[model samples]
Each structure stands twice: as structure tokens, then as C-alpha cells.
Target: MSAQHAAPAAQPLRPARAPTGSGAIGFVGPVLAVLTIALGLVLVRDALAVAGVISGDGWVVTVLDAMNGQTRTGWALAGGIVAALLGLWLIVVALRRRRRKALWLRKAAGVGIRPRDVARLARVAADDVDGVLDAKVTAGRRNVNVDVRTTGDPYTRDRVREVVTARLAALAKPPKVSVRARPSSSTSGGMT
Candidate 1:
């Protein structure tokens, strides 16, 4: 007699996430690291001086003397304020989400699309309309603004919206499409 084995449970897949760029941490982290290293190096130098392995009063002694000798001044206050502001800025940057570099597409879980590429796709769709002479598209995460130059056909705007909407159907959360149609300058015999 053969023993029966039980099947393992299936785990649901996690939703796809768009890329959030490095943001301020990318710049601030290195600066902070360098400052820390410099401080460590200075402390080591000061230790060497204290041990009679180097010359001079050392930075720590000089700083301590200066702090003990001087009263709080406007410059010191200003520096403190500047440092506080820097800390606040760092907190804001660290806590806030980084800017998204691409948008998710419904075509596939691994697929992503950039705003510029979305604009290009919308422009191509707008241009496919019968009377459209030119198309310009500006795309964001939730909006696609289309400006079309057409052969003075009023219906061109509707056609552009329809075509662009259909083209962007594959997007997981498709942006709202706005189409503005204008008469083509070339067709209107305007200045070159």
C-alpha cells in the first residue's frame, strides 16, 4: 500500500510596485558618511597629538578652548538654526515617498511604463485619427493631456480621445484623457 501525500497551500502573489527613485537619501547619505569619517579621522589625529606622537594643541583642544572662552553669538545662533533646518529637511526627505519613475501596466505583472512613453503612445494614437495633422501629449500618473492640430475638423477631437483611450486600455489604472483639437496652421495658410 502506498501512502498519500498532502498538497502544500498556494500563496497569493504580491502586487507590482513602481520604482521610487533614490531621492534625497542618495545625496545626503554619502555626505553624512564623509562627515562622520572626517570626524573619526580628526579624533584619531587628536589622540595622536595627546600621546605626543604629533605636534600642535589638536582640534579638540582648540574647539574646547574656543567654546569655553566665547559667549553665544549671533553667528553661533545662525549656525544652530541652519543645522536645525538641515535636520528637518532630512526628516522630510526620509519620511516622504520618493518620486515614482514608472507606472504599472495591466499587460503583465513585470511590465512598467514611463510617463514619457505613455505620452508618446497617446500622441501616436491621436495622430492616427483621420484629420489629425499633429499631436502633442503630456502624460502624468493620472492624466493624459492631448493637443492635436487637425485639418479644421470638429469631430477630430472625439476621434482622438476614442483612439487614445483605446490605445491606453492596457494600463492597470489608465489616466484620464483630455483632448484639445485646433485647426492646423499649415491648412489655415498661416505663417510658416
Candidate 2:
């Protein structure tokens, strides 16, 4: 009997759908945490000072008297407005939902490449071009943008474009690709 080998199954060329995310938590959670801690600390400090547990220079009493004065209406109104705005912002942040960062590549042999992975691939492809000092790729299902930084003395814009275009084309399904070249910034050479 002869040994037989099975060919691998074909992979689909579809981008992965973007993942849904509740991103407000990322912003609101941190802000709320900091504000809560700071405010709580202030309250505790005030209580301790008032109880003679800590020495104070009467700054709190001065602030309170000023706030309680009859002519402080304008300041009170401004403070109220600011507080309301902050509350509104906090609520909006708590309720907001956003898409997680990741592009879905059409199904691969087993797993589809993410936008991040595609970006890395694009950067690699760009870096392979001559004269490239650095490369950064922002990949999406609809487009791929590769920014190449070259040595100041040697420009490789065209070569970077051609190489990136070819590499993207070799993918299962290629999106529209654009390559931009510029002189390297202060940062040292690396792919992003």
C-alpha cells in the first residue's frame, strides 16, 4: 500500500466582523474611581480636622463662610453648573458602548487574522523594502494604510509601495492598500 497525504482545506477570504465593546467603562470607571477616592479623602480629612484630630489653619472655615455669603450666588450657580455637567458626562460615559479594536479577516484555515495582526503583517512587509527605517500599519477590513519612515539620506517610497501592495495582494482577500513614506522621526527604527 502507498502512503497518502491529504491536502489542506481552503481558507475563506472574509474579514472578521468587528467586536462590540462597552468602552464607557474604560473611561468612566477610572474617572469615577479617582474622583471617589479624592472626594472621600477630602471628606475624611475635613472630619478629622474639625474634630481636632489634626491641626488646621482655618482654611475650611474661610471657604465655608465665603460659600455661605449672600454675594456668592454667582459662584454657587457656576459650581452647580459644573457639577451638573460632570454628572451628565459621567452618565453618558457609563451608558456608552463602542466597538473593540480588531478587524476580522475573512476566515483563514482555522482562524481569521485580526486587524492588529494584519497591521503587523503590513508593517513587516513594508520593513522588508529597501531603505525603510521604520513602518507602521493601520489595517481595517476596508483599507490598509502603511506609513513607512526611511533614512533621511535614502528615500524608498516607491519601493515600499510596490512591496506592500504585492504582499497585501498575496493575502486571501486584499483590501485597498495605501503606502506613505517619510523621513524617520526622532524615534529609532522599528515596525508598528
Candidate 3:
């Protein structure tokens, strides 16, 4: 007896928004530098106190007060917890600084498409339609709106819609398409 074979199923494609190639977050360096400077200053201050160059009374008093009583206050605990959480968040963000690949990386990189680029491409696609005279296109994260000035042909708008929808559909995540059309004076002259 022979075994039966089955065809493979197709999966939906993810959107064309690819990851940006930039390394760790933009703010990570600045934030880390600030923290490092603050820590260094504290270290220096403590060293000077140990060496008797400066009196430790101020910090010592503060630490004593905190340990003795101030911590019991609701506001103090809340503030300390908030500060600790922020520090932890900063550290985590620094460690995994790589941003998600969904963003367009760079102009030279050419790995991903920007909204403006999408709009320009949509305009070109719309213009390619036979009766479309001019196409103004705007592309957003989830939408592409096209305003078409077309030859007086009654089907011009529908044709533009078809062409643009087909073109943008080539993208991984196709944005919602909206098309509006008006007859242009160019209709009397010919395709512009």
C-alpha cells in the first residue's frame, strides 16, 4: 500500500516594516554616562572622607537619619522604590539596546521602506494607470490615501484604484487603501 501525501499550507506574511540596523538605543549612552558620573562623584566623595580631606558628617548624618526614621514615611519609601525601578529599567534598556527591526534603518541601508517612499511608489503606480493624469499619494503606517486627477474616462478612477491596490499589495503588510478621483483639464489635452 502507498502512503498519501498532502500539500503544504501557506502562512500569512508579516508587514514589510523591517528592523532598523541601528545599535543600542540613542539615549542609552547619555543616560549611562550620567549615571557613571554620579557614581564616580559619590566614590570620590567617600574617598575624600576616608582620607580626612573632607568631613563625612553630612552624608553620615543623612544615612543615619534614613536608617533611623525617614524610611518609614510613605513618601520616602515610594520615592526610593520609584528611583530603584527607574535605575533597573535603565540598566535593562542599556543591556538590550537593540531596537526592534520594524523601523526603517537608514537611507543608504535601503533595507526598509519609509512612509514617504511608499507614497511616492503609490503615486507612480497610480500614474501608470491609462486615464490617470495626476496622483497625489500619502502613505501612513496603516493607510494609503490616493487623490487622483484623471482623464474624463468614467472608469479612470476605478482603474487607478485597481492599479494602486495591486501595486501596494506587493508589500508584506499592505496598508488600507483609499482613493478619490476628479476629472482634470488635462483630459481634453491628453494623459499628462
lDDT of 3: 0.73
User: Compared with the true structure, what per-residue lDDT tens digits does model 2 show for residues 1-192?
Assistant: 334666668986664455656687777888899999988888888888888988983456768786675675678799999999989988887887675554434434434556678778879988888788888888886688887778753447767767777766645567788877677665653432
Residue clash pairs of candidate 1: none
CA lDDT of each candidate? 0.86, 0.73, 0.73
Give per-model TM-scores.
0.79, 0.50, 0.53
Model 3 regions lying over 4 Å from their true place: 1-24, 55-67, 91-112, 127-157, 165-192
- Rank the models by TM-score, top first: 1, 3, 2
| Model 3: number of backbone collisions | 3
Stretches > 4 Å off in candidate 2: 1-22, 30-72, 108-115, 130-145, 149-159, 166-176, 182-192
Q: How accurate is candidate 1 locally (lDDT)?
A: 0.86
Say what the RMSD of model 2 is. 10.0
Candidate 1, residue 178: the lDDT equals 92
Number of clashes in model 2? 7
Error of 2 at 104 (Å): 0.8
Better of 1 and 3 by TM-score: 1
Q: Please provide, for model 3 over 4-93, each residue's C-alpha lDDT reduced to its tens digit, 9 standing for 90 to 100.
A: 566667885654545554565467778789879987887778777878899764465467676884426788789999999988887777
Enumerate clash totals for all models, in the order shown.
0, 7, 3
lDDT of 3 at 110: 36
